[model samples]
Target chain A: MGDEKTQVHFGILGCAEIASKVCRAINLSPNSILRAISSRSIEKAKQFAIKNSLSESVKVYGSYEEVLDDPFVDAVYVPLPTSLHLKWAVLAAEKKKHVLLEKPTALDVGELDRILDACESNGVQFMDGSMWYHHPRTARMKEFISDPTLFGQVKTIYSSSSFFPPPQFFETNIRTKADLDAFGALGDAGWYCIGAILWAMNYKMPTTVTALPATIRNSDGVIMSTTVAFHWEQEGTTATFYCSFLSHETMDVLVLGSKGSFHVEDLIIPYEESSASFNFTSGASFADLHIGWNMKEQEVQVHNELPQEALMVKEFSRLVKGIKDSSIRPDTKWREVSRTSQVVLDALKLSVDSGFKRVYI
Target chain B: MGDEKTQVHFGILGCAEIASKVCRAINLSPNSILRAISSRSIEKAKQFAIKNSLSESVKVYGSYEEVLDDPFVDAVYVPLPTSLHLKWAVLAAEKKKHVLLEKPTALDVGELDRILDACESNGVQFMDGSMWYHHPRTARMKEFISDPTLFGQVKTIYSSSSFFPPPQFFETNIRTKADLDAFGALGDAGWYCIGAILWAMNYKMPTTVTALPATIRNSDGVIMSTTVAFHWEQEGTTATFYCSFLSHETMDVLVLGSKGSFHVEDLIIPYEESSASFNFTSGASFADLHIGWNMKEQEVQVHNELPQEALMVKEFSRLVKGIKDSSIRPDTKWREVSRTSQVVLDALKLSVDSGFKRVYI
Candidate 1:
């Protein structure tokens, strides 16, 4: 939020369960306000708002188009299914509304590129809702991994995000429907895993990706569980990630470097709202043998004034405000990082289709 | 150890560095004794005993054959390179000495079967030197993973054992020599990862093994680092493991189940000598929502009365004593598990050789 001319008012373009979390995040963010909610029916949108205890002033709209048409809404939070992202996100940008698109930003990078192009031409900020990246703990982890003296060169990364959905959700969830999300768990749970891997590698794209075998799928041909390995051939860095909707919930990212290693159990969602933590170990100076045991692990704890999602909302709002208040153009860094993650996801999906073959990125 | 008649005497073959650890294990194991030590040079063997602070009563032999031929040596611990395993292990069994063999147990299943066969024929106990298996922490972790209500069916496992060896080891160590360990990191570090995966799956053989791409190799074409995936088709369980000598030391075994999850960071070697821990989570019943926030992780700690390697020695000594004092046959269970692990490792090595193709078990 700048002077009175620039506050990011958000219109949530669906009453999806995830939208509930974002609405709270918008409320918590100092510069953002949840101004409206939308659904296929106005009654359902009103019920969702009431269930989440939204402000009395928040508007309820029967159609996503109506939310986009509202001039008072400066930004649109697109929490629609993957198939709807390209159309709605592009439309929001064309309408001069900043877009906070939900993840698996589009069915593939082609659609994501089109949306990014729309945002670029329209001078609207574009960012996928990758909330965990905004966590303070992530920044602290980056500092440790980037230290050449302490960590040396990064060699490998292993990330995993899996959760066994309720048995009934498998039959009803849009994520499992081919026409809706299409990529299934690779698009849903795997998106976070891929993002973490790419982020740990300093956004360097992998040369190739190979899907691990025994990918489980539902009758609808939606992937339920799978693993993909990424190789940075020139850098001699490798990464592997596991994603699933059929396994117990476990989120982790482990970065192994020549001189040190870092690990975090709750990478996607912190176990607590107040703080998060990571473990790092830089080899002891006297141990030229590269033994980790000689070094005492530094357990770093990062306290957050607001939840990660709120931080993400605040960051997005700051960008949107910068565009509105100054002659500053929209930041392309968010889109660039999102595109890299999507590219890896597309290759992994291709690898699964090619019988777990190695597909170059 | 056996009042007077049942002490399990031991003869060490080839004064390998790892033998120092096992020699200490033998000393600490109440039922076992280090009766003899062997090296190509008798003076070298004497020097090793003095360096390791061995008792003056222990004998030092100039050759491995002489130690095997010692009638009073009831058992022999073979810490030779993998290329020498099949020959020395069989010869020791033929001499009626129980064989506690260091792992990669053999280069392939055929060689392992030969060693197992020799042990069977000569009525001698056979157990790989997978010291961590005998740790009390392992038993405690097993109970949590096996609980049908708490853990449900194990859906996936991810295990990794990697260490950044000193640069000189690449040129000087037997592990990196093609004619010695041949498989390199796949044999030295990967063996523990594979064993842990198989152990998590209750020793069930995988239907197929697939090598992940970007397997790093040294000039001699030995794998410096690599990841392999295993599929237990009928059991609907999948596992992946990464092993390396070119990265920071990280030993982890993560088991994801339908209802719960378990993680142990130091699976191969505990950071401390006296105790270790594992993290387990059984999700809250009401929140079947697949969000993990409600489940409080239970950190279970296990203290050891003796070091894990010592416990392994005690277990092997107990089995050897059973064969000597009673009408007990050698336990086939140990051979069965070791054989299964070797079969998977063989398939993985074959997969790596076949241009990362899938190799059926």
Candidate 2:
């Protein structure tokens, strides 16, 4: 392991769109390589490998387990449908392979807990594929929000991520079925919004959540739309978030404070060269007139051009390399993120199941 | 009832700041008159009446019951703390006086229902004083949102109204005491936001609600911060709302549709002279580049300078005058408003009690 260039070979469990991004990142990153690709159809897997320019050194498997059994593959990235996340994550853990699972991690808390336990017991690293948290821009936003001088007493946070889903995206398979824990906009897109809020707010699990889900169905009786509001509190600060997948494309985060408000607009898969503007109000009065003073706009330019998937892979590689370092314990952060996501997902399900009642976590 | 003007002489149940505005409006409006004022002390009531330049013809009562019993008073305005709202409202209805109660008509749905029954049995109109609904600007907004051709398909509606409570406003008294049903932020402010969304969406009850309440506290313990999210659906449109008393003053509403989105800044109590802008994006694609055209900003010149209390008085006056008209059915509208408010309040409580479980109306 000294200088043999300890490259961690990876196998993607599904040839999904997200898998393409991860494969591209692995191919581009120095510490990792795309070793194999698998799909339900061997033809699809071979086509993906060929299109991505994988050499004869890489294998295309017809089944997920075949790819998992590849001794050369040190880890697995599960880009399968949400319902399949837990099963494959646990399988990967049982095989003693690191797991980089997609957003949501699992359909519900029970599944998430089981996967987490399996990974812990097997001594396998587990990380949710939340690229936004690894993005440098998010780190900057988090730092700015936490700075008392710059933000001056956080008051309210309003975030929205809404876009029309791919036509028939909700009707095809497990993703659209309500019984599978896949329904409406929240499960598909709102999860990301909730994750962003939780991360920025320092994993402040909402004490109680009253959610109202707007249910919309496609022509085939599949759910197509869901809107949710999350009321969150930590310490003395209270934040409310609005998310939807029914409206036209919109991705923005607004933070209001005692002194002023800052807004990060168009944050979805945010461009690498994107910059955020801050509007600072300077006065005691909440009036617009007072807000006009020192209402200066400051822009923070983010120059990192690394694709989000690459950043996520880079972070995971760094964590794996640092596993032997006594100070570098990934389990603490992993547990917090996993628990927060599970709590939110459970709260959401409770709300949905109880007709959108307030559920305490 | 004939050519002679029949004034609805009214008395205030509390010497609230809103009551002062109502007294002024009563003096200014021709169809109504301020007959008396009441408080815990006669001297305070006298001073209030004198400061407001009420005529010597007007009387000052020492207690709320005195105002209710005064024969000169034909109607009553209850602006007491939230917990006391139901009690006083019930008393006013029992006294056979038409009542214009403030927002959050009652702490709970049962209380509201009882108030409604009492009002109906006593043959008096019990209107929830949601003054914004009567504003000419709100009427225009309602008309715009309802117009299918202009707006096309309504996808989602989001609104936020937050403000800090007055100092010591959350003491053991009615509005702040948890046991007294004085919800911190939801009861104080969230209700208005909910009412506004309901009004805009044509009284569509939310199918389900998930609410997260702040920690409950009193002088001895933590009283919960009131925060609520209501998800409502009608036809295919989904509406989400966030309201709190914890946020720095904010009032905003965003309505998203297929063709475009309409945004109302400072919607709770908008600036008298500001314009309402509509951003229209027309195209088959959901991308921003497909945005076609936007209508020019529409400036709404509000010539009327009366405050909310004044507006409520004027609207009530009109309702009272129209009560005798064969074509008018103000009680029907009042009942609807009361019912809607009750449903929202009840749904919020259910969310809280059920650990923020989703509850259908």
Candidate 3:
């Protein structure tokens, strides 16, 4: 942080496991600092602070409202359960605190819209906690995909986001409990897949969303796994993604263009924090008699000075700073991006509910 | 060949561009030798022999029947269009000559069954020309997918087979003609996709086949590109594939298992003639806080002494040798594989025909 007086002070609402990661990101960001930690039980919040080795100058609060009420808290990072997002995120915005909400931003677009409305009405910045978007490699991939002659028109896309957790995860994880996180893997793991697909499409809403008939559900009616497809009728582009809680870990995205394609294996999280790479090939064709390819995939490597989460925090804090120091309005680009992803997620769920029918947006 | 008299003799039935490659493969296989070449016209057949630099002893036939009638021709490689497969394949088998047929085995399983029945009744071995199946890398991939502990159960699979042909291909290629290839890209490119998916599933037929609505077609209503899905209801597995003639070249197959996953970018054709590799990750899990993966993908490389096409010829000839020397019956495994792929391909076409509805197997 350049100056304590000018840094965007962050207060974490609820001591969720993800909050610990963000706390470090806030500290790593040059324009942000973690100032408060909150939980329903003050003792638990203090324990989390100690576990994370927070600075002695940081404050601990018994309730999220206390952090919201703190004048020094310039923004609130809400990593609460999906069910609690609409409540706290809206309240944070109502209290004039910039909100960085965790994904599956809300239960559905209805709830997501309400949260966005609150942020817009209160003149506060809003961004979902999809940190992979901030990675330097993602930008590099965008450049290649956007290239006209090298990449050409979009053709088809595929993405997979999955992880096989331990056996006990199905029994007690908050993600498996219906009321705690109703969308389950679709909300947790699928959020990233949908986000990545939409990002590659430049956040354009798909014409139709169809859930494949292979979705698996837990006893509590939470999704354990799913396969879905999106089609852009106008562009003749199609995308499919598989998200699961019961498969080997994977975060892969493959984008095929008319003249080129790219594949990223670790899209949601880099295998390494310092650098990441994706393989791409442009104008590839078969060699004589089709015995071999004329070209091979070229790896594009990108080095990042900080982790993607830190970059996310830095970007959010910069927006907050612009609002505070220059009387600039909050950026709506992030909110729009989150809104598009949420809408697509909602439609996919609708398709699943309606017997895998193709639901038009 | 170790013993010239013991080697299987191959007679190619056409001078299609692909026939030149198989001609070379026949010569490359130690257990097989190119004994004759044929075309509709004697001049074209003579030119093909000279262009391929065939041995001076190899016979040149003005018509396919002459090659089939030749007593020295032990097997015939049919590289004719789909419309001509049943006529020539049946005649070849009726003449006691083994058959090596090009893919999209036939226009449909009905036509395929007729050709296969002739082979069975006449005691002749029959196989489809899918060279990738003979690649050493394919066997290595199968080993991983079959390992119970290392790969576990298959969760989901995806494949893409595509190529951007020159503009003239759209106007004059046999694949674009309705009566010549009928199935177009679905038959030409989609055959490999169907075969690859079924191979990963041990040749089991899917319960349902559904065509995605994003299929593109040429002006003649021949499929230019299409996407399809397969559901194995009993095993709770799903697979999707994209096949096209209007996109950049891509031969990708990704299979995700419960404990492992593998991605082969050059599944249909290797990037090199001598060696190929695929990336796989087994027992993958997220590291603490999900900042990174516990393990990264490992590259497994397989080297081959001869090209995959030559290996295909060798395998086919080995079966022919078994029958010739030891009174062995034809291997039905290859026929069964081709039949299953044809059945699925037919169902996918049915789905497309029925307005992208799900067709039950």
Best by lDDT: 3
Residues B111-218, model 3: lDDT tens digits: 999999999999999999999999999999999999999999999999999999999999998899988987899999999999999999999899888888888887
lDDT of each: 0.86, 0.65, 0.93
Tell the DockQ for candidate 3: 0.80
Report clash pairs, candidate 1. none
TM-score of chain A of each: 0.96, 0.88, 0.99
Candidate with better lDDT, 1 vs 3: 3
Report per-prediction Cα RMSD to one decimal: 2.3, 7.2, 1.0
Q: Which ten residues in a row have the lowest lDDT in candidate 3 chain A?
A: A1-10
lDDT string for model 2 (A110-157, tens) is: 888898888888776778887767666777776777777655566556
lDDT of 3 by residue, A1-361 (tens): 5688889999999988888889989999999998999999999999999999999989999999999999999999999989999999999999999999999999999999999999989999999999999999999999999999989988899999999988898987889998989889998999999998899899988888888888898999899999888888888888989999989899999999999999999999999889999999999998998789888899999999999999999999999999999979999899999999999989988998889899999
lDDT of 1 by residue, B1-361 (tens): 3443567999999998889888888888989888999999999998998898888889999999999989999999999999999999999999999999998898888999999999999999999998889999999989999998889998888887888766788889999988888789998889899889888899988888888667888888888889777777786777878898887777889888988988888887787778889988887322322222875578899999888988999999999988998969989888887888888888888888888888988
- Write down the worst ten-residue block by lDDT for model 1 chain B: B283-292
Report interface Cα RMSD per prediction.
3.5, 6.4, 0.9
Angstrom error of the Cα, residue A127, model 1: value is 0.3
User: A1-361, model 1: which lDDT tens digit per residue?
Assistant: 3332456899999998889889888888888888889999999998997899888889999999999899999999998999999899999999999999999999888999999999999999999998899999999999999899878888878887888777788889999999898788889889999999888887999998988677888888888888777888788787877888887887888888888888898888888788989988777332321211555467899999998988999999999989988869999899998999999888988988888888987
